[model samples]
Target chain A: EPEVTQTPSHQVTQMGQEVILRCVPISNHLYFYWYRQILGQKVEFLVSFYNNEISEKSEIFDDQFSVERPDGSNFTLKIRSTKLEDSAMYFCANPEGVGYGYTFGSGTRLTVV
Target chain B: AQTVTQSQPEMSVQEAETVTLSCTYDTSESNYYLFWYKQPPSRQMILVIRQEAYKQQNATENRFSVNFQKAAKSFSLKISDSQLGDTAMYFCAFMRPSGTYKYIFGTGTRLKVLA
Candidate 1:
């Protein structure tokens, strides 16, 4: 089965540095998303991308965060400045289409020190 | 807003026994979708099963099935003949039925299969 793939399975960055997490969604998938889970918190939605634009985003998705589908296959999430609280597991998911269940990638564990 | 709650933070089951993880949600929309996802030690999110709120009949996938209660706004997962490999963190998710956006995930329930 085809799967969503994320690069840099684990990343370590300084508090003020920028980090960009990358994801390659399933080739035929139309919708993509980024979600983060704090050590013991719920998985929260960051943003959803479709047609090269942000379709939806949650309150947690603030000025510090931004998502871009630079090309047809690559989706990226960039954090301007990392904070200690930014440490968490970031998952990238893709659904066949809208309203369908999403297939999640292994996840990239971001450690902001 | 829609929210998913998994009250049980942790659960354990004998290797050969059956186990059920509880999940409840609050949603105003009449039509939507519910899902069960598993995350093993590898941290890979895997789809366990799914149900359409409009469908009254329960949805089952092999030993993994769901008891979807539309009236009570509850969707629980039942794992039968549980095995050691079944140990993982289980998450119940809610989504829009029209295929519009991302999902709302529960805090998650960690399941351990004892040998």
Candidate 2:
């Protein structure tokens, strides 16, 4: 079966450094999203993208965070300056564009020191 | 706002036994979607099963099935003949039926299958 794939399975960065987590969603899907899960915490929504633009976002998706569909298959999340609290597993998910079930990627584990 | 709650933080079952994981949600919108996802140690999210709020009939996939109660706003997953590979963190999620519906996931129920 076709599955979403993310690059950099694990990443470690300094608290003030920048990091980019990437994902390639299923080809036919239309909607894309980013969610973060702090260790032992609930996954929180960050942002959702479609038509190369942000559709909706949560409070947690603040100025420090941004998402880009730089290319047809590539969706990325960039953190301008990482914070220690930013450490968490970032998941990329896609829904059946028009409307439907969600399928998530393996996740990129971001660790800030 | 939609919230999914998975009461049991953890559960254990024998390899061949049956196990039920409970889930509940708060949503007044008559149209929506309920889902159960499995996240293994690899942290890969896998879609297990889904139910449409409007459909009274529950959804089942092989040994994995769900008991969806629309009136009570409850959706539980039942795994029959569980196997060692069934061990994982099970998450119950909710989404709007149409429009821009992002998923709201529960903390998750960790299941350990003992042989």
Top candidate, metric DockQ: 1
Model 1 earns a TM-score of 0.96
Which candidate gets the maximum lDDT versus the true structure? 1
Residues A12-88, model 2: lDDT tens digits? 99999999999999886667889998876677888987767798999999999998877777998999999999999
TM-score winner: 1
TM-score of chain A of 2: 0.93
List-wise, what DockQ does each model earn?
A: 0.74, 0.65
**Native-to-model Cα distance after best TM-score fit, residue A62 in candidate 2, in Å:** 0.5
TM-score of each: 0.96, 0.95
Worst 10 residues of 2 chain B by lDDT: B95-104
lDDT of 1 at B104: 89
